[model samples]
Target: MYGPLPARDPVFSRPLQPRVHPAGAGGRLRQFRHDAFDRGMSPLLVVDHVQSAGPEMEPLPHAGLSVATLLFEHAQGEIESVDSAGARHCIRPGDLHWTLAGRGVVRQARARGESLSLDALQILVNSPSDLKQQPPASFHLAAAKVPLIALPGSRLRLLAGQLGAVRSPLVLPQPLLILDGRVDAGATVALPLPAGWNAWVYALSGELALEADGAGTRALPATTAVTAGAHLADVQLRIRGVGTRSHLVVVAGAAINEPLVQHGPFVMNTRQEVMRVVQDYEAGRLGRL
Candidate 1:
């Protein structure tokens, strides 16, 4: 087989209670539920949609999956949801918002300013039918609370992963790791792919040289693609850039692999029976024991 792997970036190797990705190396980017979706075991939808500064978005729906939003900036915005612990909430930069669409909660995003700018990450996590019995939960973390780690040659923000001593709040149902890394000019950063998970890299800004499966190195220009290795274990992402290279990388693996039937935010095994959910709601199943 292959020789023992090399050492990983020390900045990420030591940590406490952090959500580490399932192991392996790097892999190809395969569309999950749709062509536009990212390759997460759970259905992933990444969009760069343009929004008017003060425009309010339409009510969005989530039934069988977990929904989370991370705002970059653009101060004027609100997210309202009836089924959430906080029925209505506002969206602001460094805001870590998560909503469980149990019972199919609805929400809208209202942006302020003159056609305000919006940048956020919305994740859809797969949940089996049994979990649907649980009502939704919501949380908002200040932009400042997100863990930011600075290495000798690069900088990193642990949005959903652990970087050294920093940790994130958005707990994932699956074994997943999400990271945002910025490589300084002429700096090099190495990411150690877990032992059994798949890896995909998305270039958001700048350019860098990368080595995969030890097949030499190649330059990854901006807006490049995610690659799945011929073998699931050939997943390592190394970066070397004269200028800063900004990236968003997601590493994930197989789900619980159970039945994931869902309808209007209710995740259950059978679509035919929605009455229990109704009766439970009427009786405040979530509200009561």
Candidate 2:
């Protein structure tokens, strides 16, 4: 019986910094966290920007989570992934791979080609409590299927959910919006966020500024993220490219507000549930690739 918020301006939060970590061979990762805005980031447990140079990823098990990997424009070579169900996916630039590990699933990926370089965003979303015990599933969306919004000064790719008249073909267990795009220097784009939904903006490169309806503009530097939302009002976020062209991604979803217990790749409602999932994976009940 939830409804949309009343029409009003949006509220903005301060930027959240990312922690740089090493990934695969000669690869780098930037992980973002915002504990103070947990309510605004519910269902969104992890957001990682990864840069890899032709290294294979070890198989990892996950349960009670929905994961999405979106390749950016600078990505080179191909990423081939295989899952426990024996399903294989070949992801290219601008492609997306989404997995719903309701119960459990094991997956791994490797870079293909001589150049052996890859750039992508790996997002981990928590599943609702009710769907935590369901079966695992996955799908891949080619770059061609993603809708594009071409503006005078910017171009946005609808990776998931809806944006204006455009919508992504990839479907998930819950409603979520993801936009990846770039804005030209000195140009601005206005993005609409639904009432009661929480949104996070990430600066992939260059500098940018974000302004909400009634809030002052805030600077968003490279490799940083900022949150915005209003519990009872629909809001529009204005993003302006500063100094130089900017690349960014926007992720938004309604707050689940459920107790979240996580251990590594397992996300559940309680520690007991997580332990059970871990046991299932260790016993090979989750399956092998």
Candidate 3:
């Protein structure tokens, strides 16, 4: 077991950087990625916040990367998603959509006419050498199916990985834990981190104080993310809601130290491999919707 480190100051405290991109017809995407803090947390590449919606969202294809998209906010409506594996699924708000782009696959996700808001977090976890050649796959976990733990003035939603004896049905090749926590003012919660995993906490709303391993607690404001160093292990976090109701997302994963190269949507170990992925996508290898 790893021992906790002293409470330290926040590695960073700032707002999310804004980005504009096109999605489908009549629909644009407002996305944010915390790239300046990308450390060698192997298997994990980028974390993105996306809000995309309109009257309708057309099908868009992506390739060469696996993604776990967690939808936290959305209007009452349905989402139609299809893959080259002939798999089709309908998703609702407060659901999670996971796609392993292995070698490659074509994917299309669109709002079912009734939805006008689609807000989500798209997590990019890099596939290692052995798993990168596998066929593409996807999984969905509806909102109703997600487990929620209630405490005094607080609630926790276990999104992925394990929380005590409760494990998420969505399995990944790599070990990761994703949880959403909410606490009313003055409420405190403690969550233990598994040994040998690097952790991160992103405050979504309100304000909170996070203390780990007896270290000094630090303030976390909205849109702010703190990355606990890869070397820090066996630490348990004590979180307190300071102002109003605080909401946060917790992500933990084993430290990955592999060489990484990324180009657009392709994540590989070398630039040559990224070029190959580009050629394959242009050649229609990933397939069409």
Candidate 4:
């Protein structure tokens, strides 16, 4: 059992109404960008919901950061990803891929065929200051390996981190929790959140309402995101599906609260460190995919 939400807890709700950006060649890929840092949601830097139709390939370069990609059930076809470390993976629907870009890493992903499509969320997490300089690593969690919790009218998938006794097999760079939740119409699900941790909830589809103990309920429509927590008391987020079935994601992590210097994909503690990472990548020291 968790305690009531603190009176001082700040809750924020915002719709995902950002301008759409074109990615990949010929505008085959569309992306909705959400910057958590700019919105005062720390630990999480960016959350991008990307959709692609037809063949597309994109090069990703990173250092001193962590990334997680979650694919939806409706996602079609497969994606082939190759990294500078000679690691390759085939990503399909309902799969979760986590990457730790410690020192530096170059990764490229492409649609396997023209007939396939993609709908997924690409999340960027800030690495701890101490582990930012380590070697790069990656982890893959197949759809079958993900843990699921079923309720009366709701099903929750633990994509990463822990929920009660349920835990994900994949190891993350920091303590974080990622949940994919589906709720039938009129169903309600209560999500327990650790004290002092920040939480972001994004509604993927359907109409929903989010209610905290002390904070009043807030409407959550499709493509909208809500953030809460960083309080001294434990909290539980109650999500109620309205009108139709609802699909959403819940991500929570303790705030890093450290200074961040970012240059494109490179994230470091200071400008000098970011410059060094950029130099290494430009000099071919980070390797090529």
Query: What number of clashing residue pairs does each candidate have, in the order they appear?
Result: 24, 0, 4, 0
Give per-residue lDDT, candidate 1, residue 181: 62
- Candidate 2, run of 10 with poorest lDDT: 34-43
Model 3 residue 135 lDDT? Answer: 81
Residue-level lDDT of model 2, residues 1-289, one tens digit each, is 9899654334777777888999887889989754644336765778888998857888999899887888886788888878887778898998988888888899888789888678898888888887788888878889988889998889898888998788888887789898899998888988887777788899999988998777878899998888888577888889999988899999898777788887988989999999999888889999997
Question: How high a TM-score does candidate 2 get?
Answer: 0.91
Alpha carbon lDDT at 282, candidate 1: 57
What pairs collide in candidate 2?
Answer: none
- Candidate 2, residue 249: Cα displacement in angstroms equals 0.8
lDDT-better candidate, 2 vs 4: 2
Name the TM-score of candidate 4: 0.90
| lDDT for each residue of candidate 1 in 1-289, tens digit (9 for 90 to 100) | 8999875432121111112222212211212221232333333332222222334445554555566665655434544333324456666665666666565444555555443445554556655555454566665566677677787877666767554456687575444566666776777766665544444454545776666554555565655534332234435656676465555444443333455455544555555445566555555543421
Cα lDDT, model 1, residue 182: 74
Instruction: Give each prediction's root-mean-square deviation over alpha carbons.
Output: 10.2, 5.5, 5.4, 5.1
What lDDT tens digits, residue by residue, belong to model 4 across residues 79-153?
777788787888888998888889899988777755666788888888889879999888898999999999889
In order, what lDDT does every prediction score? 0.50, 0.84, 0.69, 0.79
Badly placed stretches (over 4 Å) of model 3 are 1-34, 38-42, 55-64, 214-216, 230-232
| Candidate 3 local lDDT, 1-289, one digit each (tens) | 9899754443222333345676554445544443555433445567766555634444445444577777774445556778877878877777877888887777776677544566667677777765567788887888887888788989888878887778877777667888887899899877776656666677778887877764556678776666654354477777789879988887778765566677767777777877877888889887877
Residue clash pairs of candidate 4: none
Best by TM-score: 2
